[model samples]
Target: MSEDDEDFAGCRPLLFTIAYEILGSAADAEDVVQDSYLRWHAVRGKGIGHPRAYLVRTVTRQALNHLRAARRRREEYVGPWLPEPVRTAPDVSEDVVLAESVSMAMLLVLETLGPDERAVFVLREVFGYSHREVAGLVGRSEATVRQIAHRAREHVRARRKRFHHDPGTAREVVGRFLSAAGTGDVGTLMSLLAPGVVHVSDGGGLVSAARRPVAGRERVARFVAGVARRSAPGTRFDITSCNALPAVLFRVGDRIDQALVFEISGGLVHGMYAVGNPHKLGAAVTPRLLSRKGHETWKP
Candidate 1:
């Protein structure tokens, strides 16, 4: 690859990640990353003091702008909008910042902030950019950036739950829930949920799913179980890794249906996020999975 192409290649992951976190859509993030790369190419070898920082700045600004437009679209969204579930590698489980930042709960909290606040928080809090660097990237005074950072930090802190990563506990909880669900055992499923458990499903109007968050232990349990009982006769479920945590992947024939991710607290499941939006699933699922006929086989 040429030097400029090489530079873009080296920084692509960081750029895409920043965009994804800010916009909550891998598809939008990909567009932002590509736009940033083009800008980088145009200004390449122009005595840029640090290419990496420049790329970060470019990607962050692009993402923030995209986020502004996205907020408007979200107002018109047909159902509860969840962050696109991106497949994370195993090593992400060990990175505390990554694990916490990408969690469904955290992303939902981030959604509460303004575009600028989200950008500052992602750059200053999650990615560890200095206040001055973030100010330069977002074109705000360092003092202003610091103030925004503090506000954003507190906003997220107040809303986001502090989750202790317990992979062993998570795996066990997910396994038990899956077994209970597959057997259509509502009582067993209810026993596994926390008293104030919540279930959120994202279908993005392209498939079948709950339009609003299902709250309460008994309601959430039955919500999950009712869907479980409606699965196709030969539907198969597998325990797999998704978003750096143990999750259950449902499949029917060759089509990957959905990924059910559970959030555990103490010994019970506190939150369940079912991502059935074929658009959100992206290339991770087969073409068959996106078909309306396939999606009708079950719900979550």
Candidate 2:
């Protein structure tokens, strides 16, 4: 392979990873990565000192630009908007980081921030970029980057508490949620949710869903029950780990219709994010477990 090919091979994964972290859409991230590769090849012979950093910076800037435009598009969106789904490898470390960084609940909270604030927070907190590095990537002063990150942290904390549950606890809670929803057991579902739980659904105008967040346990419970009643017969609910956090995916005749990703605070369910947009559903790539279960035709 040529030097350009070698660089693309080495940098593509990292670039995609950074883009996904910023944009929260795998499709968009892939596009950003492809675009970055084009730029890389265009300047192949250029002397770049830190190739990894250069790629990361490029991808981040591209994602940031996309996000700025996306925000405007969302202003006229028909319904709720959710982040795209992300499939994960069944690994411990990756899952843990993903649960916190890419969870639907977290992504929704991130939408409240400006593009620059979101970029700064992800680069500094999720990717562990140094303040100086983040400053360079965002073209801001180091102190400004720190300030943006600090403010973003506070904003997230005020909206939802950190999820500190062990993996086992998360699995257990998600299992109960799946069982409750599948059985249409409103009582059980209510029992598991925190007193002031919130449910946010993003149908992106392609499907019918609440236009705004439904807050409070009773409202959320009623909505879940209504969905259960309307579910097509023989629909199956599976407890899967999305982004390394416990989540539930609903399958209708082998096609994934919706995914529920959540936030757990102090062992209680604080928030539930329902992503039903067909566009967003494309992120539900076939899991390895499905292939081993003798299932075919499952695609994201």
Candidate 3:
């Protein structure tokens, strides 16, 4: 590998993680990283004191710029806009804070923040960057960054609740949910869902899905089961990790038709996010990209 490539190898994942958190899109994150790489090449041999810092700051600025422009497109989104789900390994980030920051729930909360606040909060909180570093990265004064961080932290804290994850219980619930739907037992399915459980699907208008979120256990259960019944004859569902949590991947032949992620709280499924957008499924389904586990022993 070239010197620049080797230098960036270690920090590449971190850059993507930062960009993804800021922009909430894997595809866009990759673009930011790529753009940063080109900029790195252009500045080669410039006696850059810190390449990692330079690259991260460059990527953060790119993501912030991209997000500012993309907000309009999101405003015109055809349906309830959802973050593009990406595969994450348990060890994707050595820091627990960074690892957990990408959860769908957190992403949803991040969506509500302004682009600058999101950038400040992500750099300061998620990645553990200091107020000064965050300010330099986002091109704001330390005081301004602190203000944004405070506001962002307070906003997310108001919305984000700590839900302890129990993998065993989560896997069991998800597995049983699939089995219940497969058997067309709506009652059993409803029993596994919380009363306020919501089913949100994102097809990006490239495919068919519930444009608005489907709420209520009974309603979500029915919607899930109905979609199950509509699956192709040779389809398959396998338990896997989406955004570092238990999720289901629907495979029709070799290509993935949909990626479903569930949020388990209080021993019941509280939220369901189904990504049916074909454009976004490539990263969500690549076996090499994500970690997977089977739930053959799941009982309803």
Candidate 4:
């Protein structure tokens, strides 16, 4: 490989992670990384002293631009919009902070932040970038970055309170919940859900799903059972890790029909995010490796 290629290749995982956390879409993250690489290729020979820092700055800017441009589309989206699920390796769960940062609930919270705030918060909070570094990456003054970071941190801290369950207990609960839902066992489902459980489905108006969140254990259980009863024949469910947590992937024939990721706490399911949009299923077919400390070895 050329010297330029080697430098960018070495930082691809970290770059992709930064972009994904900022953009909340693996596909878009990959695109941003690729775009960054092309830009790097064009400028690498111009006495670049720090390849990783430069690449990260490029990716952060690209992702911020993308997020700003996507706001209108997301605002107009039909039904509830959920972040695209990314299948993650088991080792990712070993890092509690890393795992929680990528969870659907966390991503949804991030969606509430403005583009610049999200970019600053992710670099400062999730990736441990210094305030000066974050300011450089996002093209803001140090004081501005700090203020945005503080505000963004406060917002995330206030809203990010799901999916802190014990892994073993969470897996067991998810397994049983899936079985009960698949079999239309409302009684068992009710026993497994929290009294205030909330279920949100995002089909993007391209598939069948609840346009609004279904709340309460009884309502969620019945909704889950009803959906199961309406599922087409030959549908298969595979329990796997998504965003470093246990999740269900529903397949129809050879296509992924939906993904169900739970927010488990107190040994019971408290929040459920069902993503049925086909556009967001790319990660389900091919898991992406993630790293917070430049340790990821997965290519593509």
Candidate 5:
């Protein structure tokens, strides 16, 4: 086996972890990891030790570059921008880490940080990298890295109370949310939402959506009930896990029309991310029951 191949294999998991932390989108994270590998190979013929650290640095830098551009684009975004949701593996050995690293709430909060600050925080806190290591990776002095990380920490701490939902409880809450939405039951939906729950939909201007985030249980409930009515007759919905939390997927005539990813806190729905853009649905896989052509099936 080539040295580069061995090194890449050893660092794949860590690379995904770092990318996910920085970008908060599994699809984007995978793209960044692939890009990192290409860059690694381009320089592979050159002798280098500590391949693991080298890969980490390369991936982290690529993620930071993406974050820089993403931040600029979001400033003028049509509406609330949300991180892409991911489906968790059934066995969640890293549930706690995922809670902190991949939560929708944490990712949204990360949007407040500068690219460099986000990189430093992810490297030091999420990956356990030392200040010196982060400094070297980010091309900053150790003291500067320390300061950036500290500032990022304070920013995150200010929003910590907003992300205190247990993953298990969040799953149950989402299930109830889907049930309420499916039956067009406003009371049930209102009961599940926190008094000040926020609903942010990203139709990307291609479809109808709120121009800004809709806050308050009554508003969110009314919006969801209206959505339930527009769904094509015989349309089916399922509550599935996405991005390490529970989410609802709407299927119409075999095509997945929408996926509603959420953030729960204090046993109530605290945040709502509705992804209706067809482009965003590219990563969604067909459910097993619908695999066969003409099957016309949907399952929760």
Candidate 6:
């Protein structure tokens, strides 16, 4: 490999993560990173001081552009739209801030922000970039970037609920939910669910799922139990992490039918995002490596 290739390769994980956080889709993030690499290759000998920073700026711009275009597509999307779930290494959970940044709930909150605000927030809050650095990355004035950051922070903090369950609490709740769901135990399912529990399934118009969110503990419990009881023969469930949180993958043989990630607060399930879209499920076949620092293998 050429020196230029190696240099950009070294920054791929960070670049992919930045794009993923902004767009909430691994497929789109990979495309943006590849396009950035092509652009980076075009100006190899231009004496760029820091290839990492240069690639980051390029990827950020590309992702922002892609996001603006995607808004129209999402408008016409069928059923409830949820972010594509990506698998992460277990160590990612050790960093509470990093884990929350990629959580399904947080990603949904970020979806409400404008493109520029999302870019600024991800760069500044998630990646630890300063106002000046973020301004340079997003091509905004430092003062303007600060305002955008403040506004984004307030918006996020207002909508985001604190997830206070420890790993053991999460595991126990998930285990019980799975058992009750599999056995069609509606009463037990309701017991484990919060009073206002909500279940959202993203079918992407290609599969069968609820077109809107299912709310209330009883309704969600019945829905979950009904789905489980109707599962195809030989169906199985795999416990794993989706976006660095406990998740269950429903599978038939080797093919995954859906990926459900839970939101546990106070030892009760408050929310669940089930991604039944086949396209979104492919990215989680292998866990992607992520880091707050810019050094790790680019692809996993």
Query: In model 4, what are the clashing residue pairs, if there are any?
Result: none
Error of 6 at 44 (Å): 2.1
Q: Quick one: ranking by TM-score, best first?
A: 4, 6, 3, 1, 5, 2
- What tens digits encode model 6's per-residue C-alpha lDDT throughout 1-300? 997688677788888889998998989999999999999999878987677778888999999999999989999999999999998777889988889999999999999999999999999899999999999999999999999999999998899866766777898899999999888999999999999899999999999999999999999999999989888899888788889888888888899999999999888999999999999998777788876666443321
Candidate 5, 1-300: lDDT as tens digits: 786677576567667767877876666777998998888889876876566667777888888888777777768867667776665553332446645566677777777788898889877876667899899888899999999999999998897544666667877887777778878999999999989898889787776777788999999999999988887888877777665566777788888788888777789888788887665665544321100011112110
* lDDT by candidate, in order shown: 0.79, 0.74, 0.82, 0.87, 0.73, 0.89
Please write out the lDDT profile of model 2 over residues 1-300, one tens digit for every residue.
986577567556556666776777877888898998888778756887666666677888999999888878888987777787665545623445544676666777888888998899888777777899999898899999889989988887787446666667777887877678767888888888899898988888887789899988778877888887888788877776665556778888868888887777667788888888878776665541110111112111
List the candidate 1 regions with Cα displacement exceeding 4 Å.
283-300
Off by over 4 Å in 2: 1-7, 90-98, 141-147, 150-154, 157-160, 265-267, 287-300
RMSD of 4: 2.6
lDDT of 5 at 148: 95
Which parts of model 6 are misplaced by more than 4 Å? 296-300
Model 3 collision count: 0
Clashing pairs in 3: none
The lDDT of model 2 is 0.74
TM-score of model 3 (CA atoms):
0.92
- RMSD each, Å: 8.3, 6.6, 7.0, 2.6, 8.0, 2.6
The model with the greatest lDDT is 6
TM-score list, all predictions: 0.90, 0.84, 0.92, 0.95, 0.85, 0.95
**Error of model 4, residue 205, in angstroms:** 1.0
